[model samples]
Target: MFKFNETSPRKCWLIGHRGAMGHAPENTLASFICGQKLGADMLECDIHLSKDKKCVVMHDESVERTTNGHGQIRNLTSSKIKKLDAGSWYSKKYVGERALLLEELLDWIKEQKSCLGRALGLAIEIKNEPIRYLDIEKVAIEIVKKKKMESRIIFISFDHGVVKRAKSLEPNIPTGILYREPLADPFKRAKELGADAIFPRRHLITKSLVQNAHKHKLFVVAWTVNEVKEMKKIFTIGTDAIATNFPDRLNRVLSNAVKR
Candidate 1:
């Protein structure tokens, strides 16, 4: 397991948000591979249960935005979802990339680790909310356990119940709450829900917020920050990690900062 507690103040983690979405199609295997190749310390992706109950990798509940197919993810069977063109919308270079099953991605990650000789972290966001998919958390947990990547994976969600359920099912797996607006006592809210971390929108992150989270033994991971200036600011404020659409850009900023 990648230990968030062991992170140094100066060394913040650069997480690939939706597998370097700025570079490749979001939530596809190609994008995740691009993120790893670009030196991301961690990668983040969204998961939703298909009609047939298989875990599918996609950020949107609907496939219209990211794929050649249209309709809610839960309404489509894994066979139908797998046949959609998931990459052409992004670029011709990624044309044949299809939506990946969660298990497929996990297997690929394990192979990558063996080749790299290091463990890579993954933040999986459960997208079952407003219309809950029954036992999605349990299914996801079982998959992670089967892969023996429990320590390398962290579960996060905008739904408080989902976060709570994840912790309840597997207390050892790190869970987090994702919020966009400013919350009163964010750390306290997260702690009360049994979350180990708080994932806030980039602009919502402040030095005081990071300090407060650390004070409560909760880590702060800011999301979707792609600009060099914003990356530098978040780094200065000392977030535990910055989730970005461009891991390469963040890596460059970190390298320059180190040189300076």
Candidate 2:
């Protein structure tokens, strides 16, 4: 099995989607902290470049929905972007939450590492599509390399071109091609891009697809798996990892189902 992080790969890996979004606020620093506390082995987050080209941890192309700001994320400078309250929309308890810089999130994960005694992996997904934020992959590479997280960070993207760009910069770092549908020749596409992993939307992940990806020596990962039934199905199909909003729940369910 591919070892991600210094963490033992023995346990079924738990990857928190947007960092334990079910318990705290999605994609906020607080949510990530909550995820770590809830026994998440790895944290998954989306990356989008600020107008000034700094990588920030967020999933949306527009800021109007997630933050108090009103514009496309590509249109705002990091300074202006930082000032918006990112949490109040979720609840009053999270009133002052602000967008987190990728560097800050990395530092937080590193700190958690010291206590967990396991290298926590980060599934960093590139959010720029339709040719916006042309330099996002470059900025993401610089951050991952600088932090010495090249081994543990799995770079994934829906934009296959972005994944290709990342692989070009550093082939050693694992890259996953994220897809919403089961392509007719998924293995061929992954091989062409030099992708180490194939991440498909949860429902689309089947035993045949998993087997097909493995034929090309690619690891399989699935996203947004939050239910015990779905989680059980994915586990039986044998994915390398799963991105989930409810890591703790899945962990317990998985443990029970397997034990029974």
Candidate 3:
């Protein structure tokens, strides 16, 4: 059976957020390669639909924040968006690194699978909020199925409907709901939506949330936690996975946990 909850032989899964943004430019291939090198069990990337309806791997609706270009991803064609210098903002060494397609990332992952001896689960956060991409879930899932990588993917989105639609289309694919707000009952909400995982804001992760989520057979993957002190707290709370910008730091913490 496919399992996203279990991180056996280790206390928790170390997921690289935006491909270890702390080490390399977020969502760039260098970042993903760095994440895998640093021992991430999964690598996270954001997705948005370009003007021509191509799936682009990025965290923002606009390219201004992370790239040399300035425009909304939905407004630009994939060819236009893909040509931007996505790495220069981070460092001169990465100046020529261009933005990538979801397909490109999948291909790289496939190439790395044999070398690493493990396929990293991709925590694909569908960027549908603040600028909804029509039919994005279908577009995204279709690529995963085409690559034969549905078994190694997890669809997460702040928009509940996105995950719901994705699950409705492919029941075997694992889905997770992301929320920063306090919900009356998240586990119930996830169960109703057919999501087996919950990606809650780190602060909202209480002991009861983790325990009850597991009680309901749902898993919890906390988001973007960077500080070591906070990491230890989340570890104490027992999240299934802790997504972070520094997978190396998280790996160190997990190693120390084993030592103690």
lDDT for model 2:
0.80
Candidate 2 wrong stretches, greater than 4 Å: 1-11, 114-117, 257-260
Q: Quick one: best TM-score, which candidate? A: 3
The sequence of per-residue lDDT tens digits that candidate 1 reaches over residues 122-189 is 89999877668898999999999999989888999998789999999999999999998988878778
Pick the lDDT winner: 3
TM-score of each: 0.95, 0.92, 0.96
Residue 146 lDDT in model 1? Answer: 98
Separately for all candidates shown, the number of backbone clashes (residues 3 or more apart, or on different chains) is 0, 0, 0
Q: Model 3, residue 67: displacement in angstroms? A: 1.2
RMSD of each: 1.8, 2.4, 1.7
For 1-260, candidate 3 gives per-residue lDDT tens digits of 12775663568888899998998999999999999888788889999999999999999899998999998999999999888999999999899899999999988876564122566678889989899889999999999999998888899999999999999999999999999989999989999999989999999998988999989999899988999999999997888889999998988888789888
Estimate every model's Cα lDDT from 0 to 1: 0.87, 0.80, 0.88
lDDT of 1 at 75: 97
Tens-digit per-residue lDDT, 10-128, candidate 2? 33577889999988778899899888777677889988887788887878887887888888777788888888999998889999999988988888776675123577778899986
